[model samples]
Target: MAHAPAPKAATAAPVISRMLVHASEFRLNPSRRVVPAGVLIIQVKNIGQDDHDLAVRAANGHILKVTPTLHSGDLGTLRLKLKPGRYWLVCTIPGHEGHGMVRSFTVKKPVKKPARRR
Candidate 1:
């Protein structure tokens, strides 16, 4: 009789990275920014005493909605896979955006090849 080989073990998938953005005073701290092109994890913390939302718009007029509404002291998270491009981040709470609660940012593509040797 012949002996059997051992079975291989399965591996778990890696977790997607995230970016934290706090919502307060109708503004986002570190307003202007950039992220790597891939899965994006948005952590929204509503510090105001009212409901707020995290709305995003792409350069091509496409809308990528994050949190619809978050109550005071509440937290909302959105996981989205995005491509490299410019996007607008805003809190669509009445005159929030108009009150300087909106900001623009970009998603840069990760560098592929390393520098060539001399």
Candidate 2:
């Protein structure tokens, strides 16, 4: 009997942005503030000794996705397929946002390629 072809493994999305939170600090630092419109993967590293999470929201305050709470030294990732626009990233850990744990990001429209002539 002939066997069927094996399935291929899924590929990981490109990590566009990276963030880190230090222990005892009420801040969330992102490596990039701008990204090209498409599948976005934000990798957050919890280098601090505290629990932290990430939230992505639209300009109108509509939440898109939230990652689970990451413990100290834990790595959490947030994946979003977004359009070109402005967005906000906040850490809703009680008073974390109030303590300046929020950041704004923008998704730029993809540039069109030029046409080629024969």
Candidate 3:
């Protein structure tokens, strides 16, 4: 007689985090100031009349990721896996960050749910 096939192992669902960023002439606004550590998808929209781009920087003064230049009314997206720490979103264009085009946000560990009692 033939043996039955092996059962597949169970896996946990992945955690997702999302953020919306608005880029203007002299400012960058985020939808939220905090999120859980996991895969993060950031949607950047250029709401100003000038071309702009977004750069993700860590608290250690290192640039993590950057998006392509976006013209007025343009949109771009950036996907990253972030850990529990603080990050900054800024426009790398000349004189942009100095002109108030920067924002700081935080990420925390995901909260674990309590197990059900029988």
Candidate 4:
């Protein structure tokens, strides 16, 4: 009988990209203002006493993604696949956006590695 080959070992652990935001009565604070192009896991903590939500808009002023309304002191998460450009985060609740519950983030292009010489 032929011997079976051993399974290949993992070279490295897959990176878990994440972001944090604090949602209050009138503002959204993002931990990062810029990130590279890829999928990002966003976590939000509602620090205010009112219900709030998080929405992301494209550079052209169109909403791309949004999370459900979370109660006060609740934690929420949103996963977004970002491309190279700018994006805005806002709350869509009545009078929320008007009250300046908005923020911005930028996605930079991924750099290519140099080719190896023969």
Candidate 5:
């Protein structure tokens, strides 16, 4: 009998940006930081042996949440847009927040366009 050809695997969308958050005693890697006001790509890698969540609260009281059940050597990514302001990012897992998995970051406004010359 003749054999059939193997199926090709689907390619994933390329990540424009990435942020690595390591799980530890109540804190994210690089606890405090700043990002530009635009599409922000965040990748959370759970270096610990437990599942973790990535959450963000905007200055306008909006919330974004992502939970990745990270087994050892696992990772997840979240793509989001942020405005200029101060925001809070945290992992709300039980006992995780208190342990220091919370962090604060600022988003700056995009530069304005230059005026046209006559």
Candidate 6:
């Protein structure tokens, strides 16, 4: 008797990428200003002496993701899948953004690798 051909292994998607952001008195700083479109894990660290929270807003003024309020020395995380476009990181706390706690970033389409020659 002839046996059936073995099944080929399946390919899995890439692992989630990570980004770090620092929240201080009146500023929000990210480790990078540009990233590829995919699953993104944002980690926000409160390095100031007050309460702070982070919000991911789209260019159209819609809020996408947000992290819980973090106290001094506290850490919070926000996980999201972003499309290729412009986004802004801001502190939603009243008066915080007016103090300059906002920054812009860009997400680009991921690069595709050509298939290997058989």
Q: After superposition, how far is residue 31 of candidate 4 from its true place, in Å?
A: 0.3
Per-model lDDT: 0.78, 0.77, 0.94, 0.88, 0.70, 0.94
Q: Which stretches of candidate 2 lie over 4 Å from their true place?
A: 1-24
Best prediction by TM-score: 3
How far does residue 104 in candidate 6 sit from its true spot (Å)?
Answer: 0.8
Off by over 4 Å in 5: 1-17, 60-62, 112-118
Q: Compare candidates 1 and 2 on TM-score and give the better one.
A: 2
TM-score of candidate 5 relative to the true fold: 0.70
Native RMSD of candidate 3 (Å): 1.5
Tens digit per residue, CA lDDT, model 5, 18-115: 45667655567743387767777777777776677777777676677565655655777778877678977777777877888878888777656698
| Tens-digit per-residue lDDT, 9-115, candidate 4 | 87744334688999997999999998878888889999999999998899899988788899998898988888889999999898999999999898887666688
Sort all candidates by TM-score, best to worst: 3, 6, 4, 2, 1, 5
lDDT of 4: 0.88
lDDT of 2 by residue, 1-118 (tens): 9899899899845435344433235777778788788888887877767788888889999989887997888877887888989998888789888888788988888666678877
Tell me which residue pairs clash in candidate 4.
none
- Residue 76, model 3: lDDT of 90
What digit string (tens of lDDT, one per residue) describes model 1 on residues 1-118?
A: 8779778788644335577778887787533388877787788888887678887778887778768688889888878878888888788788988987777878888656676999
The residue pairs found clashing in candidate 3 are none
Candidate 6 lDDT for residue 28: 98
1-118 per-residue lDDT for model 3 (tens digits): 9999889898767778899999998999999999899899999999999999999999999989999999999999999999999999999999999999999999999999999899
Residue 4 of model 5: what lDDT? Answer: 96
